[model samples]
Target: MSLFKRAAVSEFASNASVVFSTLIIIWLSIVLVRLLGEAANGTIGADVVLGLTGLTTIAALPTVLAAAVFIGVLTTVSRSYRESEMVVWFTSGLSLLSWIRPALRIAVPAAIVVGLLTIFASPWSHRQIQEYRARFELRSAISQVTTGEFLELEHGARVILVEANENDPEKLGQVFVRIKDDPWHSVVVSDHAKTEVAPNGDRFLVLEEGMRYDLTPGGLVTRLWDFDEFAVRLDSKDAEQTLRQSREHALLNHKGRPTGLLLTDGKSHSDGQLMWRLAIPIATINLALLAIPMGAVNPRAGRSFDMLVAGLIALLYFNLINLSHSWINNQTLPFGVGVWLVHLVFLSLTVFLFWHRVRVRAPKNPSD
Candidate 1:
């Protein structure tokens, strides 16, 4: 390649790397905070938080790649103009079209990475996320119990509280339990509670030195039982089976389904998902094209105005992509119409800007 093309490509790649790194760090920080919150709320396991965060970052890669490529093109080209390098290129018989070659070099690799992410890696990561959540929810209720927290299980039919753990976290101390059903209320207090998993995989919370009090609705009498040990099964067999079925059904959710499945399926949500994946690569190139013209700043005035316009355009395009996906998914717009409209519009704008920059800016004949 020519030295000029080589230098341009080098600058574009460097800028993309810097922008990509910054965006990833910011995005990962936000995702980690949210995942930690989920772990703390007992919605997910603390042990799986890092794994989930990594998967989330993978799922977010395509958008980050697209924006980085966009900004990289914009910044590199704007810097060239600001430094009068474009003037040098123009004086040497090079036109705005010469920028396309270097931009394409960067865009092609970026788009390929985006295609891999959106087509294969992203869907897989999303499935992992779903499985993590499903398993976390399906774990035996006793396993989710933490010291000094009130936990409700069996659809709020029973509540368990552990005031402290004496020897080990697995062995609870000063426990309180409450059970409420149709016409009865039961409360139990124990000196300590420990969990035992039976040979059949059934889990029981065994309370030691506990007294149980049972009160029936509209009855003046209450029954009390005092025992050295008490055992209660944590979850019914039916609930486990139901949870398995729900998780199986979740595979059909948009995030859980693979890109290949989404491509073949005719459902609106699936089509929207598949289209959005395909759109990323195309939009990446189109945005790079848009930025070339946007990067052409009036050397007299500050280049900030040009940068402001580019930022607005990039933001507007990003939001439109999302809005179009929602509209297509909800059947408010036809799939083909909704998916391609934003890209086509921006691509057309890019073409017009390039034409104006190349033709209108050319020196006119003195006679004319």
Candidate 2:
């Protein structure tokens, strides 16, 4: 390789590393904060925070890497222009188009990484996230109880307090529960408690050798009873509703499905997902090339305008990619067309910009 190409590739690599690190740090901070908030609210267990954070970061790598490569190419070229290095290269018979090779050297590899992530690793991470949530949801409210702390379930309609059994960490001892049933309030005190799943798939908290007291509001009536075993249904209406909302909130559907499955399905929704997965890697290459033209700026002029324009173009590129997904899924656009239309448009823009730059600002020939 020529010295110019070597220098360009080296600079691109360094800049991309800086950008990738910065973006990953920012992304991780945001994800960790959100996951910690969810953990605090009991939406997810605190123990799984790190696991989820890692998986979430894996799922986000493609977007972060794409931005890194794009910005790397843009900044590298723009700096060359600012430093008069481009003028030197142009005067030596190298055109603006010469940058494409070095830019692609950085871009093509990054695009492959993005492709692998989107097509395989990302979906696997999403699937693992869903599995984590599904397992958490399968646990009964009674099983969520932490000894020495009062636990509220079904929106505070039921409250439980239990002490740990020293001999068996999994067993609960000295269990007390208060249930508010509007017209009547019931309280139960039990020696020990365990969770049992009925044959019909309902969960119940089985209180052993317990005393039950039922009292009316304002002490209008009171009844007391003793029993060897008492069962309290854990699948309350409010709990079920909460579970449904949680499921819907985390539902990835096609996003979490394997690529092989997506290909075989051949449905519009699956096609839409396929479009998005394929678009990310394609955009990585297109945006890197597009930045070559965008990076051409006058040394005498302010950079704010150029930066703004470049940002808008990149934004529009991704937004249109997203829009194409919606259109394909809705059947408003055919899969074949929707997948290529946005990419072709940007590629055409890249080619036109290169041509204009070469024609309008072509270096003067020494013979002329």
All models: lDDT?
A: 0.86, 0.88
lDDT tens digits, residue span 1-368, model 1: 98889988999999989999999999989998998998888788999999999999999999899999999989999898888888988898888899999999999888998998988898888877777776676567877877778888777889998877757766878889999976889999998988887776677889999999999978997989998999877864454675666566656878667887787888999988887888888888988888899898877779877888898998899899888888889999899798789998999899999988888656889999
In angstroms, give how far residue 364 of model 2 lies from its true place.
Answer: 14
Would you give me the overall lDDT of model 2? Answer: 0.88
Separate clash counts for every candidate: 0, 0
Error of 1 at 136 (Å): 1.6
RMSD of 1: 2.6
List TM-score per model, in order: 0.92, 0.81
lDDT of 2 by residue, 1-368 (tens): 99889999999999989999999999999999999999877788888899999999999999889988888988998998888888999998898899999999999999999999999999888877886776676677766666788888779898889888777666678889999998889999998888888876678888999999999987669999999999888873344555666555444488887898889898999999999999999999999999999999997788789988998999899899999999999999999999999999999999999887878666889999
RMSD for all candidates, in order, please: 2.6, 5.4
| Model 1: residues with Cα > 4 Å off, grouped in runs | 167-170, 236-247, 361-368
TM-score winner among the candidates?
1
